[model samples]
Target: MESFLVLAVLTSAARAQEVEWRHDYTFARREALDKNRPLIIDFTTENCFWCNKLETTTFRDSAVLSLLNDKFIPLKVSAQLNPQLTEALRIQSFPTLVLAAPDGKILSTLEGYLEAPKLAGHLQRTLTAVTNPDWMVRDVEEANKAITAGDQARAMGLLKSVLEDNQERPIQVQARHLLKDLEKQAADRLAQARQLEDKGQNAQALQALTKLLKTFPGTQAATEGGQLLTTLALKPEVKQEQRTRRAQELLTQARADYQNQQFLCCMDHCEVLAANYGDLPEGAEAAKLVEEIKSNPEWMRKACESLSERLALLYLCLAENLLKKGQPHEAALYLERVIQAFPSTPQAEVAQVRLSQIQGQPTQQTDFKKAAEKEEGPAVP
Candidate 1:
């Protein structure tokens, strides 16, 4: 009966586990590339902590799970069983997401524990950069020429637009940082002008600052443009009003929240902005947020939680996601976090029982895992 009980528990555990939808190598190669999605290869080992955390927490997240399902042919390679494959992929980390082409060409790679939004952003950016036909990677020499020849405006314009549009793309992050530094030089020139003006050298100050404003309109340097124009009694062509500035400020705030893992607040602000815009770019962004929220309300809530709200519900969803995965040990860890963090909530009570079962206590069995694993691939659902 003890052996039978063990068998029953194992069966139940298997049933509860939500196997990532996956495809065989052949099918993955054909279908994934055809759809312009990368073949997502996850290199993992048994009993690895972050690996299991990803499987239980991140992968099980409905938003992340849906993106994986919709955007890639996911492959889970057990590094132990496939040493050759691991070595070939150069697996130095336990949970590395390899973005590969259908022909076994690795486009790029991301490693470590990524929260849902960031993971999704990285995935989308890598895929966009890799799969697109017209990506231009200019050499540093060419880029320098563009800058030195007074084409800095053109180069900066292109790079800045790309960075803004692809904020989650790793390449964009690097590009943006580089551009920001360059912009700072222009801003410094403007500041020097202000110092000259303070010293009563008005003519020299105006000359020095005017050079920067003319070169980079709508930039940090350009903030002084309006003031300088007013001083000269000249009306410059470009004008960003108070309302426009306020809108831009709000967008910046929303982007910051999105970056800081406050996705729900990001979504909320997006929605409000969208309503005002009447189906403009912000509206489309808000639509995307609505879709993401619908896909993973539980995980998003946890991710977007504020300091004031109780975390019991978020913990419950985490526990549930873990229960869906086969990692009881890791599931129990999060369940404890939930219990300890939000002990008063009813969700915590349910989490306590789930945690007990995860810690080897007996629980009712189910066939959901087998059914789930039987799905075609990560994109199966």
Candidate 2:
């Protein structure tokens, strides 16, 4: 009687328990990469009968469930809904399954209906084959994945390693074949870098040469690129451009600092800009800002007030941290620093009170009368 009857669907909860399917390929891929799991991408269509049957029968099988749960990230990509992705993978037939690595390297593919046991066997065999290989095949697969991810350098490294391994494996031949393509790519990049250098675009050329060296380290193109990098980097035009760019950056920072009431730091940046890059337009602008800061009475008062307040706050913060660590004397040193440095700011008053508490006595402010009488005592030179 059992032989005469076809197997029917089992428990209602069987589908949920046996298979975990992800609809979005990107999310599934991220999860797979995070977990270091391979992927089983099930390509399907709404009208596909075999695809539905697999959900009911093949997915319900205990062996299939165990293999999927333990070893793979299962994703169901609908050909109808995801036409672009389907076209990318070229999934023409309904119910096509692709087993891929975590990095999106397709390891194997199967089409049409597969009985549960046969499907499980196929997965098991794939696992075994990937595990027991001479590593040349796996390295090639990884190289392919790197290339897909826009990491040509990594791909080249893997291919180079395989070739240098000196193994008699058949996959070594494939690696050699792939490396020639990589060599050509390296040469093309080297050519591009040279062209940029010839056009006097030193910065762009420098970047290209650097990338070339990194991408094709052992290639002849990389060797030439390295030599070219040295010659281009030493060009006075390149050096001048770099210096001018740095001067502009410093000038911008100085302006921001001045605007933010960080006057002392602004002075430091201003001095560097005026001294080193004084010939450049940015340097000249920086020099003008410096003169304005020193000559403007209102600006001087604001700079002095803000500098004192900021320094006092910093000292207070340090003192508080030391106090938390149960170092009262250490805390007192920073508190004293606030009194000596800024003696008039609000944080300085706070520091004085804290210092008095630590010393168990009243404290007097330090006298800077003699120092102030001298010519320019550490006040924004």
**Top lDDT: which candidate number?**
2
Clashes of each: 6, 0
Q: TM-scores across all candidates?
A: 0.31, 0.43
Which residue window of length 10 is worst by lDDT in model 2?
Answer: 3-12
For candidate 1, the lDDT comes to 0.66
Per-residue C-alpha lDDT of model 1 across residues 1-381, encoded as one tens digit per residue: 999999999997764445455635557678775775667888888888998888878777667776677667788888888788889878988888787754566777888877878788877766675442234345333445667887766667666655655533434545666688678877887878778767866556656766776777668777775587456433231222323444556677777876776876776677777777534555566566656665886746665455324466666677678768876777788777876675444555677678666667764223223433565333345
The pairs that clash in candidate 2 are none
TM-score of 2: 0.43
Looking at model 1, the pairs that clash are: 15-369, 21-377, 21-378, 22-377, 22-378, 69-378
Q: Please write out the lDDT profile of model 2 over residues 108-146, one tens digit for every residue.
A: 889988999899998886565434266767889999899
